[model samples]
Target: MPQAQKGICAEPNLHALYLMFNVHEDHDEEVRRILAQILNIFDHYDDEHYEAMVSGVIAIGSNYWMELYPGFLPAELAPFPDMHCEDRHAPVVPCDLFIQMRADRADICHAMGTAVYDALKPHVELVEQIKGFRFLDGRDLTGFVDGTENPKGMHKLDVAIIGDEDPEFAGGSYIHIQRYRHNLSKWNQLDVPHQEEIFGRTKTDDIEFASEMKKPFAHTKRTNLKDANGNSIEILRQSMPYGDMKEQGLFFVSCAKSPQPFTKMLESMIFGDAHGNYDKLMDYTTAETGAAFFAPSVDFLKFQGMS
Candidate 1:
């Protein structure tokens, strides 16, 4: 079958759209019903200060499994057959939203986050309290602009998912969440060049190291996956800066396939493969929470028990 094309709205200004859903045999219909209801709610409540911040939900489940991705993966191992299983049913972890605000507009993000939370409280099985923040400009925990090297346009499709990673769900992928705590004091002490080396890019988003001089085994490069035939995997990243002034950093939401892209990416960061070396950014960022989950295709919900 030829790959189908759908119209995605022009990108919104939202910095992050975090989500997590528990799967079940009966929950398929419930997801559909909930999604429809939420869409209506957003339309009903749409406004300048508060509008539907969703970028559409991709239901990737099939007749056998309601393939919803959690924010993190469990520590216990699963057998190959039970790999995509959804054990917990209720309290479907709530989806989160992060909107952009002016540098000093923490109050606005907070107001919007709270408004969203209140609106969905009654309908959702559970609505996790929303969190929002102002952008820190170009600097990361290490005092440098992060994601300066992010892929854009057609290239993003390749960087996200394009490989043997999962032929069954071509064009579809998984998302992972990791809450990292930064030792800012330590990160602040590093000189500019040292900071740049850790990120494997120039301090500014522009200009990358010549191929030979790049960190061969860097997280920026290794987390990048290609298919069995060497096609790059393409996945969307909607992570955002979330937290208070004293304890702030990324909410780290990465979507990909079977957790391989993310897992392998982290592995490369911790223990670099043959050519590259472990990630230097680790000296500053400390991962505190990790979870993995699947985001099912919209059609999957229709088959499941959705009304």
Candidate 2:
């Protein structure tokens, strides 16, 4: 098995910092070296604070992959699947690099961000940053538990890591992210029962409704898709709710062995089925940005970068 990056399947942390950047022209080699050895930056802090469980991920955006490595591409690598359905939107916001740092301590996550920025200074321009935290007992700001369907234990690796089918990219994972700005004021107007109906789950207990009880447009109904063979298309979800006094929403991130799962899930949510019943939750949240990236295996980053 290839050495997968530690952060890709890392357990949820108390704090996370996501940074997106655009690598400057003529700095490809320098950026490559920095990203290749980024683990050392993470290890430097993790060694002293193992209790913090600090982990990091360095990913190259779909658009920048060819620029960085002109030799070849990950077989399934593709740009963001920007989609629209009536009023629903999944907008594309491409970036050359995406780095995620997570740890139990917000301070450590911040420190990692500082170090990462320092290493890439002048070679990259920071475009966006979203700091996220565990919300109210691992529930979303919407007062519902999140990531309830995440694959557990070794199953996460099975679902999130690429296999021999794409040997060159084995152990790498396809990543898709969207910044959703939720209109909590509007969502809160609904009663618990109404909310539960939209989510297709019991809010307090976080239990999925029976298949027969699930509504066609409920989020779970739309996202819990199946492939042609009647198998569920799964992705390891790494979403968290982020909020400030003025803004609140989800930082939706997911990883899978291939990009198809992410694309298909989004389509199901936006386009719905032949009946045209889309995910009802889209009405309360706006997907502000979307990006696609590939987090290559650790060994690939280490050996391929300087090759």
Candidate 3:
């Protein structure tokens, strides 16, 4: 079995920092050097301080980095495609690198984030930086329990890591990240039972609604995808809620052996089924950015000419 990244399947803690960056064309060499330095720092501190992971994907229409590793791309790796239906639009914004730092304390996460930025400051431009946290009872900003259906234990690894199917990238995983901003004022105005109906789950108890009780456009109904053989396709989600008094929402992170599960779920939520209805939650949240990345194994990272 190939070794996967440490934090991909583990339970997240109280704090996280997600940084996205675009490498400058003229600073390719510098970026590689800085990545090596960052990786070295992470490896040196691999034990108890904090957990950090790094990954990158070539932007669509740009093969500068992909050209270095011939045929090493994830089978389903590609740029995030835009999603549109009626008045809602989920735009695709590509980034070349992603850095995720998580720990039990915000101060630790912040220190590591600062180190990463200091090393890459001259070579890359920051795209987005989000500080995520475990909200009250792990609920999202809207009070719905997030990731309630996530696969557990070895099932999470089975769902997330690439296996024999893609030999070259066996230890790697395809990831999709989205930054959503919620309309909290409007969301908070809905009554309790109505809010539960929109989520297909009980507000106070986090109990899922039975099939007969589910609405066609409910978020739960829209995201439940299955294969032709009726097996539920699953993804390991590392999502967290992030916001302040002025603006807040979810930093959606999903990892899978292939990108199909995330893409299918997303399309279903945005385009809906033959009935012509999308996820009801879309009305209360807007996806501001979308990007796809591939997190490779540690062994692969060491050999990427970083030394």
Candidate 4:
């Protein structure tokens, strides 16, 4: 495998900064070089502040990839599967670039984010910039552990980084992101037992409900998918919660070798199964933004991004 972006499989960090941008017309080449330099800025700061554990990943939006690279695209690269059922919705709000910066220190994240913003502002329109932090020991703002089923150790590479099937894009990862705004007012009205039933787990202990006892609409039941062969399908999650007193929600990030798993899980959440039993958690959270990108191996940025 090629050298993957460090941030793709890095351990959970205390702070994160996410930025989305659209390149100006006739500036694809310039933006590519700028993106490459932003990665270098991340590496320079990470080396200088090793204890901060700084890491970053830069990705190209599916719709903009061809314009920038003028080369082959990732085989599985595709746009966000915008799906809706009744009141629940997943809409597409695309971007040309996505930069992710994470570190143990907020200051480092700020510095790196600033560096990236400074470098690319002249050639790109900033669509979004959200800073996130570790919330109560990696729990979502919803008071439940997030990424509980995320692949661990080397398994993360197996799950997230493209391999021999797409040799040219090996070490790259397909990304899907959503900005979910929670309706805490409505959700808080529910008792602890009701919340646990929706999540399919014990709140205090984070224990899963037994198969016989799991609800058809439980979150875990909807997202914990299986393949035709009865094997578990997985995505490596790097999500974090963001926002302030006025509003708050999860900045959901899912990376995988292929985009199919993310789409399937999302469909299951909104459209549900043949019985039309949707994920109960969707009732309390609104996915306000969604997009797809492919973070190529660092080697691609080093060579192709500069070319």
List RMSD in Å for every model shown: 8.0, 0.8, 2.8, 0.8
Measured on C-alpha atoms, candidate 4 has an lDDT of 0.92
| lDDT: the better of candidates 1 and 3 | 3
Clashing pairs in 4: none
Residue 209 local lDDT, model 2: 99
Per model, how many backbone clashes are there? 33, 0, 0, 0
Model 2 stretches with alpha carbons more than 4 Å out? none
* Ten residues in sequence with the least summed lDDT for candidate 2: 298-307
lDDT, candidate 4, at 238: 97
TM-score for each of the candidates: 0.63, 0.98, 0.92, 0.99
| Ranked candidates (TM-score, high to low) | 4, 2, 3, 1
Where does model 1 exceed 4 Å of error?
1-32, 42-141, 154-172, 216-234, 274-276, 302-305
lDDT for model 3 = 0.78
Candidate 4's residue-wise lDDT over 1-307, tens digit each?
Answer: 6899999999999999999999999998788788778878998998999999989989999989999998678898899898979998999999999999999999999999888999998898999999989998789888999999999999999999999999999989999999999999999999999999999998877898997798999999999999999999999999999999899999999999999999999999999989999999999999999999999998888887657
Q: Report the Cα lDDT for residue 233, model 4.
A: 90
Which is superior by TM-score, 1 or 4? 4
Tens-digit per-residue lDDT, 141-187, candidate 1: 45555455456776655554423444434444455555676777787
- For model 3, what is the error of residue 222's alpha carbon versus the real structure, in angstroms, after optimal superposition? 0.6
